[model samples]
Target: MRLPKTAHTSRPWLIHEIAGDFQVEDVWALATPGGPGDLPRLVSQFVSGDFPRGAPLIVRVLWATRWRLGALFGWDRPGAGLGSRVTSLRQRLPESVPPGPGPANLPFTPLYLLADEWAAELANGTVHTVMHVGWVPDGAGGHRGQMAVLVRPNGWFGAAYMAAIKPFRYAFVYPALLKRIERQWHAGTGGAPPLHT
Candidate 1:
C-alpha cells in the first residue's frame, strides 16, 4: 500500500544521513509480513526479483522503452553511470564497507545490510536512486517490510525524465511490485538463506 511520506521520514534510518539531499519519491508498505528477524528474508526476495518478468505488461513495455531510449541517447553507457556521471553514495557512508553487487539482472549496489534495515543504490545518467527497506512492526505484534525510494535528479533532463515516468510508476510498476512481494512472502520461501545474519 502507498504510504505517507512521513512513514519513511519518521524513521531514523541511516539513509537520512547519506541521502539527505535526495527527494523522497515514494514510500510503500510492502505486503510481506513476518517476524522481527525476517528482514533478510524480505530483502533477499526483493532483490532477487526478475523485474519486468512477473510485472504487468505495461511495466514490461515501459522497461523496454526506457532501455531503448537509454541506449539510443547514451544514457546507460558505462561511463554515464556511477563513479563517472555521479560519485558513488558509498563515499557518504559513516563507515565504509566493501561494496556488494546486487542481483545479476539488476544494476544496484548494496550500500549496507543491517539487522533490521537494508539499503541499495543505482545510478544512471538521468538519476541517482536509493532503495531502502525496513522491518517495522505491523501493529499486531507481527512485522512487515516497508520501502522508500529516494532519488537525486542530475539536471533539467533528469528532472524531466522523472516527471514523465511518475504516472507509470504509480499506476503499474508499484502495484505489481507489491503484489509480487506478497506472493513471495506467503509462498514460504525467500529464494535463499538470510544474508546479513
Candidate 2:
C-alpha cells in the first residue's frame, strides 16, 4: 500500500544525506516477509526481477508506451542521463556507504549498499530520481522491505510530467509491481539468499 512521505523521511536513511534536495515522491511497503538475514536476497531479487515478460497487461502496455515516448522525445538520450545531464548521487555517499557500481542488468545505478539498505539512481530528460530500499523490522519478529522514491524534477516540465502520471502510478504500477515482488520472495529463491557486505 502507498505510505505517507513521513514513512520515508523519518528513517535514518543515507539517501536523506545524499539527496536532500529531492522531494519524496512515493513510499510503498513491500510484502516480502522473512528474517534479518534475508536482506541481501531481498535487494538482489528486487533489482533483478523481470517486470515485462509476464506482468499484468496494463503494466506491460505502460512500459511499452513509456519507452516509445522516451524514444520519440529524446527523454532517455545518453546526454540526458547520468554523468551528463546531472551528477550522480554517488558523489554524496559517505564512508558508511559502500562505493561501488550497483548490480548489473538494472536500469538504475547503485549509489550505495549496506547490509540492510540499498539506494540506486537514474536520470532521464524528465527527472533525476532515487530508489531507496530498506529492510525494516515487521514488529512481529520478522522483516520486510520498504521502498522510497525521491525525485528532483528538471523544471516545470518535470513537475508536469510527474503530476500527470501520479494517478496511474498509484493506481496501477505499484500494486502490480509489489505483488510480483512478494510472489518472487516466496517462490523464486530456494533458501536463504547469499549475504552482502
Q: Model 2: per-residue lDDT, tens digit, 152-179?
A: 9889998998888888776777777777
Candidate 1 local lDDT, 80-192, one digit each (tens): 77898888788988665544436546777788888778888878888888888889999999999998888898799889988888888878877777777787789955431
Q: Candidate 1, overall lDDT? A: 0.78
The reply for model 1, stretches above 4 Å from the true place, is: 96-101, 190-197
TM-scores of all predicted structures: 0.91, 0.90
**TM-score of candidate 2 to 2 decimals:** 0.90
Residue 106 error for model 1, in Å? 1.0
